[model samples]
Every structure is written in structure tokens, then in C-alpha cells.
Target: MLPEAEKLQFLKKTELFSELPETELKSICQIANEVAYPADTTLFEEGDEGDSLYLMVDGEVSIIKAGTEVLFFNEKGYCLGEIALIDNKPRSATVKTVKSTQFLRITRHDFYNAMAREPRIGSGMFRVLNDKIRRDLEIQMSAIRKEVAQEESMRLAAEVQQSLLPNQEISHPYVSSAGYCQPANSVGGDYYDYLSLPDNSIAIFLGDVMGHGYHSAMVAAMTKSCLQTQIPFDASVPEVMKAITRVIEGSRTFIYMTCCYLIIHPDNRFEFANAGHPQMLLYRGNNSEPLELESTFMPVGFARFCESEQYYSTEVEWHSGDLLVLYSDGITEACNPDAEMYGLERFKALISEKRHLSPMKIKTEILSDLRVYQQDESTTDDITLVVAKFL
Candidate 1:
């Protein structure tokens, strides 16, 4: 047992009694009881009525919640369960002794009666709670500010990504094209671009990074840069695919993209190199079922493992008024509340029905139809569509 003087010194160090007058302090020391418990003893449980305040004197205790240890304290003069003196609320967490421990315990009834006689101890508790609340608010406000800053950064990244896309529609005398992309987030991984090539040919490129967000968007940007550099001098289907493959293999992010590259020439002949991408569709002006532009190679990042010869091209014929559909899998994979996906066959039917419309109109109608079809699963993944019509 601590001597009377030593107990007074320890109680004075505690926040609840720190500002008490000497007379009130000695009064509390008289009422306070010394208690001891062995290790592994449970002092109280969550949801039990708060009835007593325990002032730490020695050893340690653990605060637990829902069977998980939340915190532990070993320092002298650190009070535990002090809130019981102020309120009758149930305990918020379980308390157990981690080792043989001693505490100066004060019952809520005793503390309240004592407070009526000497009010300073009561006011000091209010002061301690005020300081605690202010500190907690400061920490929460700092965290909120950090989150808002991160959101703004993503908004800026989305703007930069939007700028990287070509105008939604590109006009050419031989072939006209229109494109649309809906990112699942502020920034996304799907991207597409079309530019005129030699001999009135237009080089079309579409890619989908493995996932969405700033990192995936960065990889898409790098892939686009790789395509821009290669198309200016070469623009051939095989050469462009090689450039895209290099960018994916060299990326520090170690991610992959499903990609499609195609060249449309005045002769009505088109060459496509599919890099593990979903099938591209070509609707003949004849109104027959659309031709599926199947995958000719593995996806870009993974293609690094295979021979360069696997990165090759295939030829397909297109005629006047023929419509081409280049898209990411997000289109066919979108689901509704019922867990039903807007499927491939439905997409092909839409292309076949809308083939006669201008490429821009076809692009709009398809996107609008998808919006209706999504129902609730509208923005699960980035969606991209590029529609080209041979004039």
C-alpha cells in the first residue's frame, strides 16, 4: 500500500484531480479505495453500466472491443474508466488486466456526492473532455482535407486524360469516324484514336488497360504516345502493334492492355492486328450478319513473352457504306440489377440495325441504348466505342 502522502501525489498527477484544491484532494484521497488484481483478470466488459473510475497506479491493462485488442496502457497516473464519474453510459470497450495491477478506484456515487461538496474536481473533468474533443476534431478535419486534395488530383488527371483523346468525331472524304468513352471513375483505362494515313487511309487504334484509375490511365497515355511516334513514319498494322507492345513491356506499372489497330485504304481493303482484344465487328452494306474481327494475337503487355512473329496482321474487305465497330469488353459485359449482362449478340444486332446511319449517329444510338440497358450496373468499367463508315 502507498503511504497517504504518496497516494496524494499520484492522484494529483491524474487529469481528473490535477486542478483540485488541497482540501478537496485530501477529501478524495479519504474516499478513494485501493484495489489490486492479478494478470488475465477482466475488470469490466463492453456495455456494462459505467459505475466506477479507476486511477492507474502500476502495471498495465488492455482495452478490447469485439474480441480485438484496441489499446493498452502502462504509464502511471493514466486514468481508466474516468468517464463513469460523469455519465452513466455503458462502457464502450472491455478492460482486462495484462499483469498484476493496482488502481485507486472511485465509485460514481461517491464521486458525485463528493463533487456536490467540492465542485473543482467536476469542472476539471469537463476541461479534460473539452481538450480531448478539440484534439479529436482537429485530427478528423486534417484527414478530410487530405481526402479532398486527393479527389481534386484525380479530377485533374481525368481532364488530362480527356484532352489526350482526339475530337469525338473525325471527318475524312474516304472514311468518316466517331468515338465515345465513359470512364467508370474520374479517370479510366479505355482509349481510342483515329488519324489519316497515306493514300487516303485512316489508321484506327483502340486499347483498354487492365484496370481503371490514374495508374491505368498513365499506361494508356504511354501506349498512345508509343502509337503516335510509330504511326507518323510507318502506320502499318504490324509496325503499330509492335510499338504498342514495346510500351506495355517497358511500363514500370507492369500492366497489360487489350488493343486493336487497323488501317483502312481507298481500295476498300482493311488490315487489322488484334492484341488479345475483344472481337471487332464489321457490318457489310449488304445487311447480312456482321463479320467478327477476331483476336489475332495475345494482349500487349503479355505479348512480350511470345515471339515477334505472333504480333502480326490479317486482311479483311470493306465496301462503300460498310460500318465498322471497335469497342472494349465493357460494352458486352455491362450488367443490370438482375445480374444480367448486355451481351455480345445484342451488341452485334444493334450494329447491324444501325449500319446505314452515319457513324456519328450510330455511335450516339449505341451509347444511348447501353445507358438504358445498364439499369443499375452502368459504370462498373470503362466503356469505349469507335464507329467508322467507309464512304
Candidate 2:
């Protein structure tokens, strides 16, 4: 049994009883029993039904969750287990004695009787519980607000990135071109553009930066600027590639991009260059098989090459209804839920199946098929595809 005077002294120091007069504290002391436990004793395990409260008088105890320490209490007059008693809920965490200790245990029935007689005891504990609940809610609300802000920022960035792309497909008397680009995220690194040359030839360029994100997007934008300003429309395919290579090499940022640039003339002859990019598919009129126009040079920004390092271009002649396909590795490397790649063979078959369609229709069909193949799976990279057909 605990001494009445000692219990009264400890109760006066606790938040729950400090507001009460000596008479009420003495009344509460009647319902509480003195309990003692050895070091390392588990007072209660998590999830156990709780029907009592513990007021620490001496020694230390720890509250643990999932084998990790949540908190520790060693000071006299500290109270615990009151939350569970008030809520009539299971214990939220395991409480173990850190050393041989003594505390006061008040059972649910006696506690309620004491509160009925002294309403101040119930009011004090309820105030503490309310404050704890409010703090937890505030923390949760702050986390939600931060997540919403991040999402909004990413949405805005996505809009800006989309604006940098061509507004629509281009149609000409000698050539009709259509292109599609999608990032694996809100912003990506794949790029495609069509330029009207001065000599009645059309330049179509498609490229992919090494990866996706702000750095890759920045590099893609830099590539666009170099292609538009540093390289001229009349420049030969090799000259165009070299000019882009030189620009990237001079930049302070070390980034590489794979690109395919093609210039189509009125005579149905197109000069094409590839910089360590995927091979271009040239389908002759009324033919199902696509001839691969392979890359003859290395990827740009790979390393500083000597002036003597040679880059070459491929020239192909075609007739009306012939189609040219240029794409990034994203399409070929797209994976299904099973981790199987949508490989080059499947891409070529899709192209062959849709070869008779218009450039815009072909672009639509290929994207539709890609979506089907990647059902419920996230795209692993930025995708870009450009289709140009001789009219």
C-alpha cells in the first residue's frame, strides 16, 4: 500500500491532478493502487485491451512501436495509459520498465467513480487528449498540403514542356509529316521538329537526350536551339550532324543526344543522317519490308572527336506512297508488365501493318498499339516517333 501523504504529494505535481484541491487528490488516491515491477518488465504489449492508467513515481520506462523506441519517461509524476483508459481502446504501444520501478495503477471502474465525484479530473485529461489529437491532425494536414503543391508545380512544368513541341502535323505537296512525343513523367527529353527549308526541301529532325528530367529537358532544348540557329537548311546531312556535335561539345554541361535528321527533296530523294540513334525505316512504294538506314557515326557529345573523325549520310530514292519512319529508343525499349521489351521487330511489324495509312493516321495507330501493349504499366522512358511520307 502507498502512503496517503506520498500519493498526495505526487498527484499535486502531475498535470491531471495539480488543478484539483487537496481533498479531490486524496479522493483519487483511494482508487489508485501502488504497483512495482523489476527492470525490463513489459507493463503491457501493443494491441492489448487497456482498463487502467499508470502514474510513474520512480524509475524509467520506454514506449516502443514495432521494435523502435517511440518515447521514454523517467520523471516522477509522469502519467501514461490514460489515453487508452479514456478511449476504451487497446494499447497503442508496448511499455516496458527500464529499471526496478514503482507506479500507481488506477482501474477503469475506480477511475470513473473518482471522476464522477470530482469532475475536474475528467476535464483535465480530456483537455490533454484534445491537444494531442489536434497536433496529430495538423501534422497530417501539413503533409497533404505539401504533396498538393508539388503536384501543381509538376503540372505547370508539363504544360511548359508541351508548349515547346510543334502544334500540329505538317502537310506539303511533296511530303507530309507527322510526329508524336510523350514523356515518361510530367517533362521529358525526347524531341521532334519539322522545318521548311529555303530550297523547297523539308527538314525533319528527331532526337532523345540520354535520360529524362530537368537536366535532360534542358539538354533537349539546347539541341533544338543549335539545330535551328547554328545549322542551316541547305547544309548537307554530315555538315548538320557535325555542327550539332560541335555545339554540344562546346557547352559547359556534359550531355549527349541521339538524333536523326532527314531532308526530303521534290524528286522523292531524301538525305538522312543518324548520330548513334535508332535506324530509320524506309518502306518503298507498295512494299511491306522496311529497309533500315543504319547510323554511320557515333552519338553526339560522347567524346571530343578530332577534325579527321568522319561522319557520313545515307541517300535513298523513293516514289509516291513510300514511308519513312524515325523513332527514339523509348518506343523500342518500352516494357510490358512482365518486363518484356516492345522490341524493334514488333515496331517494324506495326509500321508494315500501317504503312498504307496517312502520316497522321499511322502516328495514331502506333501510339494506340503501344498503349495496349503497355496496359497498366508505366512508361520507362520518353517516347518520340516521326513519320514522313512522300506524296
Which candidate comes out best when scored by TM-score?
1
Error of 2 at 71 (Å): 22
Residue pairs in steric clash, candidate 1? none
TM-score of each: 0.70, 0.63
lDDT of each: 0.83, 0.82
- Against the true structure, candidate 2 reaches a TM-score of 0.63
Each model's total of backbone clashes: 0, 0
Per-residue lDDT over 70-111 for candidate 1, one digit per residue giving the tens place of the 0 to 100 score: 567797876667665466788866889999999999988888
For model 2, residues 1-391, the per-residue Cα lDDT tens digits are 6678988988888877778899788788887789999999999988999889888899999877655555667978777788888778898778999999899999988888888888888767876677657644654565566567778977887887777788877778978888888998888988888877878888888888888897777777777777788556446777778777876787687778888888888886888888889999989876778999988767888857444347677788978888999999999999899999999999999899999999889999999998899886899899999998888
